[model samples]
Target chain A: MNNAANIAVDIAIILVLIAGISRFRTPAGARFGNAMAALALLFAVAVALYRNPMLSSNATLAAFALAASSLAAWRVSAKINMTRIPSLVAFQNGAGGLAALLVAIVEMSGAGPAPGAVASAAAAVSVSLGAATFSGSMIASLKLSGKIRQTPTVVPGHNIALLFLSAACAAAAALLFAPGDPTSALVSLAFLSLAFGALFSIRIGGADMPVLISFLNAATGMAAAFCGIVIQNRLLIACGAVVASSGFILTMVMCRAMNRSLMNIIVGGKAPARPPASSPATASSPELTAAPPAPVAASQPEQPAADPLSLAADALRAAKKLIVIPGYGMAIAQAQSETVALAGMLEQAGTEVKYAVHPVAGRMPGHMHVLLAEADVDYDKLFEMDDINAEFAETDVALIVGACDVVNPAAKEKEGTPISGMPVLNAGDARSVIVCNFDDKPGYSGVPNPLYERPNAILLFGDAKATLASLIAKLK
Target chain B: MSDLLVMLVVFTASSAIGYVMISKVPQRLHTPLMSMTNAISASTIIAALLLFSSKLDSPHKVLAAAAVALAAFNVIGGFTVTGRMLKMFKKQ
Candidate 1:
């Protein structure tokens, strides 16, 4: 295909990808769609580059390069667990930045001196921005991946140094492209830029790397866009623009997840507080080694001797305001449909129903949101932690289905616990708390919850799907 | 081209090493590790900028300069941020 046709195909594929990943807040058919779109993009790249005379001349080398980069990306995506996700994202940003830097270099180095002053300026900005983002992203990835300590590695007067470097870079850029000694001035600009990138990244903390990665991703996209304008490449322009917009959106989402601002993270500010150290005395529990307990609380909450049927009947009869808290276990059990059915039954019985969402409830962010969305839960019914915490006071029954960490009162009551400062759902505040899970083990943060011992909390220990299904049948 | 290959190999190897270390280290080490990686990225910027000088008035120089600036930002800013975060741990 020719350039125009190639542009059309690329745009179409990109649109499909964008549409697929657009609903960032929920789990939908989007991930699958994105995978398919990625495949299509690969095909398009193959066709476009293969058809181009310049690229086609060294087809084998180009193919190898493309394959290597794609494989690197795929490996990172597939292998990165939650803890390593920030690093992988940072690496991806670096890749994008590197690509933009390459584009700018190719354009600026080969262009005639008269490619217009505007193009030169665009080229300069692209080169500088791309380099900064590339290095910054790599640093962020390294920090998040645990290759470096999550602390400031700066010398004194870092801000003043940055200001000077910025001034020098601008001066150098102007001189390099002027009537005299362009080469020497450009060389100096390169040196100052290098110092700037290193100094900028060495000052941030590790916990903030996620936000940094997001911001750098946006920066890399902007660099690519600038490079595209320098080279007059429509396809690059669109790709860069999409990446820039999506990066911004994702950055905003990440900030919300961390309860932080983009500027604060970028400016090298600290987190609000340190994560409390793991409690050595209470850290390891016998629950991890031994058989898990049954549905009743072992401590404070006394179990009624009623059978499952009687318990279900009581729940159906007594529940006037009911809330369901979903977790990773719900996703693992695929109990969303059954839970929704149970909710529907309770609603018909005149019990008000809602879902409480804790920010970091699941294996990944939005884990519960994805499962519930699959069951066609209304978006408006999902309440964020702060909004839902107050509702627990008037709640008649809080059915915490497969949730652990998010509902654990340990976040507030227990000092020096792993997740002490993290926010948690106030399920224990409800009149009745019913926890359904297969095990008594604490969650990823490794903290035992006091919510389990609450006066009204009941441990409905069983297969979550089976329990929910039975509850739905009983309610009907 | 050979230098680029070397940088790629170094990064790839460093990434592999990082993955192995993440699960083993204490959480307190996270910032310092990140700082080291930031330095490596700065190195990449330096190499790219040097290449830019050779390309002179060509379009490739622009790309090299961008890479250098980004690396500078990451290294300098990352250290400052990490220092502040570490203070929280120290105070407690």
Candidate 2:
């Protein structure tokens, strides 16, 4: 086959892949897009085989491996619940990284002609990054799956250690071609990079997980692209590059949503120190300044504390418009169905109900939407933070379930705090607020929530699933 | 050497276009979008299969086969899972 024909085929395949990505603008379109992207990959595999036919014996083994692993993936994905998708995706990302690592190693171990300076460099970098991404993704998967404690474990001298390991990995990669036998340098680079990846990921606190996970997705894609360069496969290079870019964009979007720089997340720059309780004098929002301090705030819910549920029930009963905000806590408590049911009941009561989703609300980006959708909520009823923030004031009631940080007014109003500068849902802006969180405690960021103290807000603290059930029962 | 240049151009071009194409994936589909991209990166499966096209030694053959399995799992699992997630999204 001529080089020109191969190039044309690759361009066509790449275009199809791009078209697939473009279809992700909506849920229905994304399903079609996902299939198109999968088909494009199928085409890539066909073209590669056409260019270089496999030996019969080798082909049989490869086919068996593909079928077995694919069946396992299918079974697991089919059975797992929506809540577990984050961990599953992370594990799959690690698998892709493992492939890139193995391919880079084989190519670097004298597969082709003695590689030139740049190709050797690319191979070394690929292996190092691939190894790092695999280990990092595994740790993330474990944390997300509840297999490991989900806490930011800050090793002593964490940042310094990461910096040293990064420098060492770079040095080893550079020295890869310096030694006659590059195996030692290559191995050391891989080990150093693995350590770096683990250390860099471990200290990132839970609140910053969306950024870390998204960034790792980008890193693995980058490693695959470098591997493609080593093998000189244009199809591999194009596909890898596309994934890298997609992951990069998601990383930036998640970071921007939280108003934190990627560096702030990876380096543990923000401290989760608890803010002083009830510091009205330091309240950042100007409108909040005139509100009387502690006594009224603390006793607000207690006056009707014995019947907070009924108060919330009455609030919902009278509400002409309601907004529901869901957080990662809702998923953790398995309250999605109850939340959706409550929304449905309210809609039936002539209340115009809508769900407001904060971008960083769940374990991963768009995770809240998936959980809500799993409960059969209409996509039309779901509103993004930017779209629904302004509507909260006009709405009669804001129903918060298993959520805190996203609706916490402090994140948007406070300064010199962990969640400072983070854009949050304007649940406080609603005419009346009903909080169904587990307690009045602060959220993942450890910042105190001033909204819980608002006089008009009803605090129904308990397991969101049970709380939502009772609320649904009352409303029904 | 010139082949290397062409490859570099391909990588740059694809990334630039893919970024523009994907930047519009709404927040609602971010999770599915990510899983789909995860499958795309599995294109390394092509490189893995190509290793089998040649007469590699037994150990290299084993490594190549393992790569093929991992990439296939990533590809098939990623797409199927994304499809399921997207399916759950309904308009009412």
Cα error, residue A428 of model 1, in Å, equals 6.0
Q: What is the DockQ of each candidate?
A: 0.04, 0.84
For model 1, residues A341-458, the per-residue Cα lDDT tens digits are 8887778878898999765454223445545654667756777777779999998888888888678788778876655666778889988777777556565445766776655655
Tell me how large the interface RMSD of candidate 1 is: 16.3
The DockQ score of candidate 1 comes to 0.04
Every candidate's fraction of true contacts kept comes to: 0.03, 0.88
TM-score chain B for all models: 0.55, 0.95
Residue A445 accuracy (lDDT) in model 1? 48
Alpha carbon deviation, residue A224, candidate 1 (Å)? 1.6
